[model samples]
Target: MYTANNIADFFLGRYAAEGKITPMKLIKLVYIAHGWYLGLTGKALIDENPEAWKYGPVIPSVYHSYKHFKNSPIRCEHDSEVTTGSEIIDKFLDRIWKVYGKYTGTQLSAKTHMPGTPWDITWNDLKDRNRSSLQILETDIKEHYQQLASKNANG
Candidate 1:
């Protein structure tokens, strides 16, 4: 597994060259990659779990790293740096970018906040608890994506 920043760097380097990538969009993409990769490989795509924040699931590290950009597009900072030592993982991430790279931050946020999504369930269940953030369980994330994959396969 790679650090969320490593994945962020990869995306920034490869996909955001000519594209606008806000912090929210980058964060959501990383979370999505973690979910699908975990579900399919039964292993983590990132080194950490996401926390359920008001808008949706967030990788705190990536969020903090890019928060300064606010709604602005962050410049790509990666320069051929190695990320996720495995080529298979790199290819899988490429696939994720191919599918979701076009979505705006709001669109990706809406996807993650959809009913029964891990962030939705966790946030709805715990938002009133007076906590700043709640951890979105990896198990729940895995199951949700697994079910999604199964549904897509069946359809």
Candidate 2:
């Protein structure tokens, strides 16, 4: 299995190859990729847990790793090879980029915050008590994205 850093590095290398990316967008994209991986393959892409933050779903480790960029676009120093040795994962990451890479950070955040989403459920449940963060359960993400896949298939 890939760790969050490995996945983050993969995305940063891909998206930030020529340009830069904000931490908010990178984290959201990683969260989306993880959810889709769970939905499609019934497996996790990474081992890290995501929290429903006020902004959207966030992987804390990824956030901390790139937090120094603040609102600036994060630039990578070099391309990092995915050492997971899984062609399947490499393909899935490519697919994730093709499918979801077009959206901006705000757009992805909107998608994650949509009604009935895992982040929505978790955020709503915790927002009442003024909580700052709530765990967005993997089960919830899997179920939600599974339904989305089914919907897209049926349509």
Task: Name the top lDDT candidate.
Answer: 1
Q: What is the C-alpha RMSD of each candidate to the true structure, in Å?
A: 2.2, 2.5
Please report how far candidate 2 places residue 29 from its true position, in Å: 1.1
Residue-by-residue lDDT tens digits, candidate 1, 88-113 = 88898889988999999999999999
Best by TM-score: 1
Q: Candidate 2, 71: how far from true, in Å?
A: 1.6
Q: In model 1, what are the clashing residue pairs, if there are any?
A: none
Q: Which ten-residue region of model 1 has the weakest summed lDDT?
A: 76-85
TM-score of every model versus the real structure: 0.92, 0.90
Instruction: Write out the backbone clash pairs for model 2.
Output: none
